[model samples]
Target: MKTKATLLAFLLAAPLWCIAASSYPEQVFQPEIVIYFGDKIGLTDEQREFIVSEVTTAKDSAREDKYRLNVEMAKLRRLLDKTITGEEEAEKQIKRLFEVENALKMANLKLLIRVKNQLSVEQRKQLRELMKDFNPKKIGPSEEVEKRLQAKIEKLKKGMREMVEIGVNPENISKVTAKFQPLINAAKYKEAEEVLDQAIKMLDDPF
Candidate 1:
């Protein structure tokens, strides 16, 4: 009974674990990556068509598997909710859920393998190089934000130096400017902008 309960708990938590795991993009070659860099990688028209067809088929299969998974999860919930559920029946449902999840993962793996096999050696090498520089966080705001933040910091630093040269207290400027890099690194643009504005205001009204 203890073992069955433990198994049940693990199975119940499995979906949440999968969801979290899926948040990170797989490092392996995927169809979307090929399509996105098709020109750069010199993908042939035939190769592009093949990849698109495979992706379409895989997406269809995944949709069906996801539907089946949701239905099985609902059934498991119903079984556990009953006042006199049998341990054996719950175990059976959990096993079915596990199988569906495994099938979904397998289908995705097959799709990725197919995509990888279709690419030429040189294209694959180029893709590998591209992937090396692929930081997911660099997807948005990009270099523009970094440039703007750097410019702001430089301006703040120059202002602080000038104020210090003139015998103004540097404590408040130091405290606020110290926060600029961290906020920028964390991509907290709004907070960083506010802090920048505050620094600018301080520099303007250093009294």
Candidate 2:
């Protein structure tokens, strides 16, 4: 249960997937702000329940807004990819995309403000540490290792070229991208590629 809780803490800190693919370094959802504390931040059962209630309420409230915003990113991509669309329409979609993205962020911020006020000073510190640890690599690497890591990252970044060559979904490349981010930061290419291989298999499999 502790292990499960630990996993939830990390995954919940990550962006919530609703309908469309998010841009890289995806925006975190409102519910996840408090859910991040349910396991790793040492909350009492009562406190955890309260946080859960708050998140559930916020998620339900934001559902429609999130879904609408989710479609915009994909819409923008499709519009840009198609040559038939004029610059005027593309400009409008770009403007709407920014507005929708901001609205989604504001919705998250409103809930975060409420959650922030409820936390004690110690809990705030714990949240800070949690965030600090969430960053994959805080330590500096050797010069030689850094170069090799950069090369691997650049290669991984172009999944359209690399992933498709191996018969994986270029569209779902975000799955592999998300899976390897932490490993890439640690310069674990061998392990990272193993993860990539597993992701490729899953992506390639016909349902």
Candidate 3:
């Protein structure tokens, strides 16, 4: 997820409800400003530079956090594949994922507050006007994405167990998982699930 960039952009124009991006706990997209707020709000060069510096830092931090989470999750998946880990370990990693996600969300709020503090009243009002057109409902499930992934993980655990008992082919399962990975990255969990389901059904057919 482009946490810092998404949050910084949201902070510039979105209102309080839209303040933190449905928040980092969810990895869904939302309705954000089409125009650049710094330009529209007529920010001075100094203010713009400050915003850029802070945003770059936050973006870097968020990227690092995301990288770590992906690494840990991959480790946990490997452990599970080898039967070296159990549900408790997987659950711990999931909790850690949520923790990092929450921290990123807070970081965004902090930056948003800092940027707001630096803005003049006129600038704030200009931002408000730019934000008035934002439509939150039109956005898909870009928020609470981790929550969805957690739930999906549980289902996957059950599915794996069922497959093992049925002597399902590992290659077949891998094919389905690989096919859906990109969809998940695109934040299309529903479509990913559909892909998995169709693949499984076709592969499991006795005919």
Which numbered prediction scores highest in lDDT against the true structure? Answer: 1
The 10-residue segment with the lowest total lDDT in model 3: 26-35
Clashes of each: 0, 0, 8
What's the distance in Å from true for residue 115, model 2? 1.4
Tell me the tens digit of each residue's lDDT in model 2 across 120-184.
Answer: 77777666666644533333445676676566556555645665777765665566558675554
Write model 1 residue lDDT over 1-207, tens digit each, in one string: 455456457766666325432344544576666666676888887787788778778879889988999899889878876767897998898789889998987787778788888888889989888867675444334578768877887888899899889988868877886886554433346678789888888997865
lDDT value for candidate 2? 0.56
Candidates, ranked, lDDT: 1, 3, 2
- What would the TM-scores of all predictions be? 0.55, 0.40, 0.45
**All candidates: CA RMSD (Å):** 12.9, 16.8, 17.6
> Candidate 2 or 3, higher TM-score?
3
Measured by TM-score, the strongest candidate is: 1
Would you list the rank order by TM-score, best first? 1, 3, 2
lDDT of candidates 1 onward, in order: 0.74, 0.56, 0.57
